[model samples]
Target: MQVEIGSNFWTYSLCEGRERKLWWESEEYSKIFLKSGRNAFKAICNYISADKRKVLFPAYHCGTESEPWYESDWEVEYYPIENNFTVDANKLKQCIIKAKPAVLVIQSYYGFDALNDECNALLQECRNKGIIIIEDITQSILSDIRHQAVDYYIASLRKFFAIPDGGVLISRQPIAIRKIAQGDNNIPLNAMQAYSLKREYFETKNKGIKEEFRAAYVVLNELISVNDNNYAMSDVSLKIWNSFDFTYIAQKRRENYRTLSEGLAKIDYLAITRTFDNDTTVPLFLPVLVKNNTLRQELQAFLAEKDIYCPIIWKKSPRIVDCPKETSAIYERILCFPIDQRYDKEDMLRIFNTVEKWNV
Candidate 1:
């Protein structure tokens, strides 16, 4: 079941047809702001109380994933999550009391779990202190859209769909936002380029198409690197996003995750960072932390030879790479397996069996 490189990145295939539900959350979210999820974080930061400049971020995270925290001009502060990515309420409360900061960003790692009870209580503490809560669900958009008590929610819809440009900002209550209209060649042009590269590879089975795709993305990313990231999603990207069936997307991802997670569980060397019950949490990917960076490289190479490629979660951010002793130990070791809707049970089994076979 091997295919072209970059074809199976976290989300499902956009070129194929599948069952879909025409679902929109206009009512649930006061206003649905369409943009890249990365920009949504910046927008949320802008909307928060102007007085609070310092925001607490989790220690275990990808550097770029939290770029909005920096872009919003807030003094970003770090807090620690356990090896499993769960926050301790007591420790978090202490940080809040010490920082007495304005905002708290809570992330649902891999979108397969919810905030722990202690963190839930701490969330109330933030409310009591009039602290703004920005929930980062870019990886777990469907799990919890609007927190009843949270001020704002942001998710990267592009990750879940084939659309090139998409990030959504949901206000529990409607608020005014000044942003630019998003008719950009960067996202749409780059996104469609991805589609074309994928299509060409599928049809022609040519590796040459990837260079064209890579060049497009290079230009697209360069544009993104310079923009303020306060624009809305493009019309073409939005149309592509709306055509998908939400029900099918979620169900397929859950089924694939269960098959892979169950199989991974049997191999104790690879530790699953989080686990969900009754499939309540629809995962973005099945994340596992190998024992060390050396082992990680070996495993990645081994998997690639078997036609399975897992990406390092993100290039670890230098700021948090060393301080959070735990994060430093395994940041390079984290690898994510694609468990999206595109693959079926057989696919999941192949992935699992390959990893298991590697262990043997």
Candidate 2:
């Protein structure tokens, strides 16, 4: 059995007629049109006046890839939590009171759940304090809070869908976006490469050959450019969204997550992140926190040998703040296992069996 776990594949494949149209309409908001990924981030930065001098407080425990894009001076104040990693309201309040940030960025980790009460309170406090709140919906798009409580919200469309490059930014305030003057309709080599890479990824999966899948990824990564202009929000992305069925994709993701969680329950030292009460999310990945650093790496290698790719989702480290040394150390132990729509019961059983065998 082979399991593919590099990224979240788009769920548009599951929908029919009017239901598909509804998905696109649901994402649009009054005065705010969804802009492409990085462009949306740029627009928010401009609206919030977040330059290189102002400080932003991001939850330190969250993913690090997006923090630098803020292009502003920043400090990180992580929310305190117990063994289960729930957001700590009191600690969060204290941090907000002390840091007095201009903007607060929050993330729903692993899409495991939506914003907890503590998280909601923090957003309210930020609002009362007149600070901007940028919600990262990259992992938690299924949560209702994406439409509520944020001055601005951003999500990577490419992460959730099969499309090459796209991100949507929804805002409460209206602003004029200067449309780019179209001249050349030439598709950039990089965008074409990424498109090809995604095709190859799925192709290898269908073939049931794990080694070929890895090779496809290597080629895909090489051809893909992280900073290419062609992949910027284009007609192709919007067309893809219009044609796909997001609801079906969301349902499949939730179903797959449940199946994997149930199958892996008996494994010791492997605990999945629990969703918060009254919150729903299309869980992006199933993260299992192991007991020790050695076990984490060993499990990763064991899975890889079987062509089951498991990766470390987040490596906790200090942001540009004077955080306590102990907090920085937790970065080494978290591992994320695959739970997307691509894996079936047979594939899940293969993963679980690998873990059980490695228990000794």
Highest lDDT: which candidate? 1
Candidate 2 lDDT, 167-282, residue by residue in tens: 66666565554442231223223445444554565666555443443455455434332332223455554566556655766676677667677767777777765743442567
lDDT values for all models: 0.70, 0.56
Query: lDDT of candidate 1?
Result: 0.70
Q: Report clash pairs, candidate 2.
A: 10-161, 10-162, 12-245, 37-167, 316-331
**Judged by TM-score, which candidate is best?**
1
**Backbone N/Cα/C clashes per model:** 6, 5
TM-score, predicted candidate 1 vs. hidden true structure: 0.87
For all predicted structures, in order, the TM-scores are: 0.87, 0.77
